[model samples]
Target: MLDANLSTQLKGYLEKLTQPIELAASLDDGAKSAELESLLQEIASLSGKIAYVRKDDDARKPSFAINRVGSDIGVRFAGIPMGHEFTSLVLALLQVGGHPSKASQDVIEQVRTLRGTGSDGVLRFETYFSLSCQNCPDVVQALNLMSVLNPSIQHVAIDGGLFQQEVEARQVMAVPTVFLNGELFESGRMSLEQIVAKLDTGAADREADKIRHKDSFDVLVVGGGPAGAAAAVYAARKGIRTGVAAERFGGQVLDTMSIENFISVPHTEGPKMAAALEQHVREYDVDIMNLQRAQKLIPAREPGGLIEVQLANGASLKSRTVVVSTGARWRQMNVPGEEQYRNKGVAYCPHCDGPLFKGKRVAVIGGGNSGVEAAIDLAGIVNHVTLIEFDSQLRADDVLQRKLRSLDNVTVITSGQTTEVLGDGHKVNGLVYRDRLGGDSHRIELEGVFVQIGLLPNTEWLKGTLALSPRGEIEIDAYGRTSLPGVFAAGDATTVPYKQIVIAMGEGSKAALSAFDHLIRTSAPVEAAVAA
Candidate 1:
C-alpha cells in the first residue's frame, strides 16, 4: 500500500501523462505474481491516466510491461519494482505516456541511433539490482528511458534477490550490475553518456584509447565529489579556464542516504544532494568530463612548466595547477569469503542495504563510530543487530555508545575480529569471528553483514607523485597545499581531521584560492602587466 506523502507525490508526477499508461502483468502461477498484481492495482488507483490488466501471453511469469494505451514500449521488469526501484517504475510510466524523458538531447539521439540495420538487431539490457541499493534506481531508470526512446532496445531489470540462481550464475557481486547483449557492461553507478558510449562501442575499454589528446586548462580539478565540484565552481568564478575529470560525479555522496550534518540544510537525501552539486557546477563555465578517470600525475619538470595528468582513457590533460579531491571509499575487511559474498550477504553501506534485511537478524562489523552508529540505526529496522568490534572498547562517541546501549535489539561484542564471511555461494547465511583476548572462535547466524570499519582514501593513484600520510591520505598544509608546488589537495583524500560535506566544501574553497594566488604570482610580467 502507498503511504500518504508518497501517494500524493506519485499522483502529482502522474498528472503530466497526457495518455493512459497501461500496465500488463503475466500471471502464470508464479510466486510473485499476486504481489505484482496488487502493486499494479495500487499504482493504477493513484491516477486516472493509469490502468492495469492481466495478459495471457507466453511472456515471463511475474513480469510486467508499460504500454502507451495501444503500443508496448519494449520495456519490461522481470521482478517486483519495489523499494528504491519504485522511482524507476514511475519514470517509465511518465516517459511512455507522452512525457519527455529526463535524459539530455544528446543521449536521446544516441539511443535513437542504436537501431542497427532495422529492428531485427535488438539491444538487450539486463540490469541486476537489489531492492535496497540506492544506486540501482539510476541505472534502471537510464536503461528504461533508452528502451522507451528507441524500439530496437529492450531493457529488463532483474531483482537479484528474487532470482538468486541467475545472480549466482552471472556472479553479480554488486548492485546496478549491467549486462549488455549478455556481456558484463558495467558494475557500478555510471552516467547516461558513459552508458551510451559503451553501448555504441560494445566495449568498455574503447573510450580510453579513442580519446587520445592533450587537454590544457588553467586549473584542472580531479574528482567530482563535493570538494572538487566546489573548487571548480570557485576557480571558474575567477574567469579562468577550469576543467574537471571524474569517473563519476557525487563520489561517496551517492551512497549516503540521509545527510543532517550539512550546514543550513537540516536534512537531505544523497541523490538529491548529488544532483544539486552537479547543477551548481553546471552554472559555471567548468568543463566537466564525466566517466573520465585520472590515472597518473606528472609534475612540472621546471618552474612555470605545465603539469600533465594522464587519464585511464589514454587522454592527457595539462594545467597550470591541479587540485586533488578524490574522496575516500569504504574499506573492506579483506577476509576470506568477503569478496565472494559482497552483495550476497556482505554489504558496505548500511543505509543502502539495511532495508533488505528488515525483520531479519544482521551483524555490524566494527566497534568504531561508524559501526556503532550503523548498529543503532539498524536496530529500528531489523529484528536484531549483533555489533562486533576488534578492539576491547568501542571507539564511538559517548553519546553514540549511550544510544547504542539503549537499544534492546542490539548485542555488542568487543575484542572480536572478523575471520570469515559465511555464505552458501548464493547468499550469506552467517559469519565467523575470533576473540582477540581469548583464543576462541565464535559464529553468528545472520542474514546480512554490514562492514562499518572505516574509509580508505582514494589516493593510491598518487602513491609516488605526492606526499602521503601513514594512513595513505594526501598530506597537505593549512592553505590546502600539497607537498608538490602548484598543487593542492582537499576532502577525505587529504589528511583533514574531519570528513564532512561542509568541511570538504570549505577546504575546496581554500584550495581554489591558494591556486589562484599561485597563478597571480607565477605569471609572466607581460601577462601580469596586461591585467594591471
Candidate 2:
C-alpha cells in the first residue's frame, strides 16, 4: 500500500477521472498477492469512479489490469509497481478512467490507427522489466498509452524480478525487454512515436513527408542533449526561427544514471535532468523534431547563404546558421563475440542491467571512474566482479579506488588488454585477455560483461567535411566556430577540453551567440552589415 503522503497525491490525481473504471485482479493467497490486493483496494477507495474485482484467470499471479468501463481498453501490471513503474501504474489508471492524456493529438490519432497483432487483430504486448531500471518507465508508459488509445491493443508490464522463470526462459538479460504477439519486439527504452512507427509500416513515410515540407529555419540545431537544448533555446530567444532535429531527444544523457556535478542542482537523475532540459527548450519558439537523425551537412555555396543538413529520413532542412551538438555514444569493445553476446550477457549500463545478473559473476572492462563505479555497484548484486583495466593504475579518484579495493567480491587486473569475448553461441561464457607485463594470455570465465570504457564522438558523419582533430573531435575556435563558416559546434563532439553537463550547456550557449554574431555580420542588409 502507498504511504500517507503518496496516498494524498494519488487521491488528488484520481479526482480528474470523468468516467467509471474497474480494477480486475488475478491473484492468489501468497504474500505478494495479499499486498497487491491491499494496494488495489486502497486505490479503489481513493476514487469515486473506481471499483475493484478479483479473479483467478490470468496465468501470471499477483497481476491486475485497469480497464475502462464498457470498453476492452486496458493495461496490466504483473507485479508490484512501486519503484520506477509506479508512475506507469498511475498514468494507466488516469488515462483508462477517461482523464485526458498529455500526449499530442497527432500521436494519439496515430496510435488509434495502428493495426493490432495478427489476423485476429488483438495486439498483446508483454514487457519484462526490473524495478531499479530508470529507462523501463518510458517503455511501459508509451505502451500503456498506446493500449489506452487503441482498444485492440493490450499491454502487460511484467517485473522480471518477480517472474524469474519467465525471465530465464526468455533469456532476458536487459530491462524493458518487450514482446508483441508472443515474439521479441524490442529491448531497451522506446518512445511512443518509435513504437507506433514500428507497428505501422507506412508511418515512417508519412512522417518523412511531413518533415520534408517544413519551412527553412534561421538557426538549425542538430542533436537534442543538454548542449542542443541550450543552443536551440538561446537561438530562438533572439527572435530567429530556430529548429532542432534529434534522433532521440535526451541523447547520451538518458543512459547516464546519477549526476551530482551539475551546479545549483545537488543531486538528480539523468532522465529527470533530460526532461527538465527538454521542457526548458519547449518554452521557446524552437521547432522540436524528435526521432530524426542528421546524416550529412552540406555547406552553403556562398557566404551568408543557406546551409543544408540531410536527414536519414530523406528530409533536408535549410538554415542560415547551423549548430552541431551531436553528442558522443558509449564506446564499445569491438572484440570478437562482443556484438553476438550483446543483450544476451554483455551490457553497457550497470545501473540499468546489473540487476538482471544478480548473484552471477561479471567483468567490468575499464579503469576510469565509470568502470570503477560500475564494478563497485555490481559487486553488491553480483556474486563476484573482475575489474579489468588497460592501464597499469586506475584513473579513478583515490576515494573510489580505496572503496573498490575494500570490496570483498571484487578482483582487479591491470595492464590487461581484452582480446576476445568468448560466448556459448547465445550468452557470454568468458573473456580472453593478454597481460602487458608477461605477454601471457588468460581467460576469466564469467556470466556477464559490462563495458565501461569511455565514449566515442558522433562526428564520423562530419569527417572530411569539417576540420577535425586527430581524435575525430570537431575542432572549434574560442568562439565555437568550426572550419565551415556559419557552422558552429559544441559539447562532446567538439574539442571542448572537458565533457561535462555544465560545460556543454555553456558551450552550447556560446555557439548560439557565435552563430548570431555571424548572421548579423554577414547575412544582414548591406548598410547594416557594413555598420556592424
Q: Give the top-scoring candidate (TM-score).
A: 2
What is the TM-score (0 to 1) of candidate 2? Answer: 0.96
Per-residue lDDT of 392-423 in model 1, one digit per residue for the tens?
A: 99999999999999999999999999999998
In Å, residue 433's CA in model 1 sits off its true spot by 2.7
Could you tell me the lDDT of residue 60 within candidate 2?
Answer: 96
- Residue-level lDDT tens digits of model 2 in 449-491: 9999999999888987999999899999999999999999999
Backbone clashes in model 2, listed as residue pairs:
none
Question: Ten-residue segment with the worst summed lDDT in candidate 1?
Answer: 523-532
Over 4 Å off, model 1: 1-12, 18-20, 26-51, 56-63, 77-83, 113-120, 126-131, 158-174, 177-188, 202-211, 355-361, 377-384, 406-409, 422-430, 443-447, 524-532
Would you list the C-alpha lDDT of every candidate in the order shown?
A: 0.84, 0.90
Per-residue lDDT, model 1, residue 20, is 78
Clashes of each: 1, 0
For candidate 2, the 10 contiguous residues with the lowest summed lDDT are: 523-532
Model 1 scores a C-alpha lDDT of 0.84
